[model samples]
Target: MSTAFCFGIRFPMFICMSSFAIIPTSIVVERAIALWKRNKYEHYGCRLGFAISIICIVVSLIMSAWSMGKMNLSDLTVYCSATTNETADRITIICFTYCGIDVITLSGMAWLRTSNVAAMKGKYSDLRSSYQLRENASVIRVLLPLVVFDGLSHLVFSLGGGVFLLFRVHFSYVAYRTI
Candidate 1:
């Protein structure tokens, strides 16, 4: 395939996949902050979350564009697999970095929750505060599993890419060539 054709197919896919990969980390951090600043978050959480999502999208766009630009079209054979080993390595590093950030955000959220619970046990105990805590807990309960799943998927993908790189295993579209 021509380089432009390959890029046309890969560019949007990269942007979408990268955006999906990044938005989760943004959400985790936003939730952590919301948990930390309870009352203030309640007032502006939606706007804050939207802003964070936009930032994630913009970051994803930039990263995808840069990576796509770095892709080696000369490597293209019968199919649209044009990325060089260096580009693959960079993508794997990015995936691992995102996974690390997710882990750290989860840890921070846990710490914040514990501190909030301890504080609630003291003089600040109130029905509204308790209700907000429960609501936050419920939201976390729902989001936690999804985030964990996303992280694990990323980890597996990164490991697979690492293994492929280690072995120098490059798969081509032989079936397409035959066709």
Candidate 2:
């Protein structure tokens, strides 16, 4: 029961970080590309941010899928009731894989932040340096928040998933010991 509860709370975080995060990243990247082509230097920061966000989103999704598939819910149920030891062990292995996925997701998001910062300093010779601020205003205000939100969400989800897994393992261990 506790294991199920933990999963219920944490699973949504995984979904939000993996799937929902992609939307804003895509929108920002598309918008940024348009601005860059138009010689909009000011908005370059936003475009750069979007590009970073896209990279993060892609990595996060890939990691999430890998982790979730390895979890194999059917095997996991064994922890709560009688089942083949082989099946339960398989689920445990899957849980370990999910842990790796969380790490990959976090690392990718960190990279996105670093790359976005670099983009801020990137050169775009086609546009006058003077227009940097002017072009950047809209991008900064809109895309920055979106990127931050996605990144934060991913981090939160990763942590939450870990906590849920830990709790599940603890309870399962106690259950097995008592029985």
Candidate 3:
């Protein structure tokens, strides 16, 4: 149960970091590019992305530290299962909640990126830069795999998580704990 609780909090962090880390990183790169090129940068999309990501992080931290913070590692023994129906339900729900947020944020970032691209195309229509077109194409190509893999990974996660939620096996036992 303790193990489940810990993972219930941490697994979402893993999914968010692994699956959607690129969005933040790309946003950072966008800003850097603007700085490097000395262009007047519109940070609206990046700002919105950062705001949403921060909100997600805060929620994750709160959920991770919520009930499990008071419990000490010394109190949990490997011999005992440490879960109740309420705990199990909360953990399951938290897991799904985090996963859902991850999916939503990923789509949100995609939507923002599309809008940014459209805006850029409109803004730069006059001075058509082949280099920029090539760069955009390359970014889209690279992002294609990221989006595909993200979707596939989330699908697998959802199915496996749904199974765990269905079986109520989150209370198996606390084999180990980490800080």
* Global lDDT of each candidate: 0.65, 0.49, 0.49
Per-residue lDDT of candidate 1, residues 1-179 (tens digit): 66667878888887876776677777667766766676566678478978998898899888777766767655544556525544666665665655566566556556655765665565545555666666667777787777777766765775565555444544553532232
Higher TM-score: candidate 1 or 2? 1
Tell me each candidate's TM-score. 0.75, 0.39, 0.49
Ranking by TM-score: 1, 3, 2
After superposition on all C-alphas, the RMSD of every candidate to the true structure, in Å, is 4.1, 8.4, 7.3
Q: Write the per-residue lDDT of candidate 3 for residues 65-175, one digit (tens) a residue.
A: 552343444343343322333345555555565466556545654664564466456544433343444454556557556655665576467546545766755344342
TM-score, candidate 1, is 0.75
Candidate 1: regions farther than 4 A off: 72-77, 105-128, 169-179
Candidate 2 residue-wise lDDT at 163:
58
In Å, residue 106's CA in model 2 sits off its true spot by 12
Best by TM-score: 1
- In Å, residue 40's CA in model 3 sits off its true spot by 4.4
> In model 3, what is the error at residue 66, expressed in angstroms?
3.0
Clashing residue pairs in candidate 3 are: none
| TM-score preference between candidates 1 and 3, better one | 1
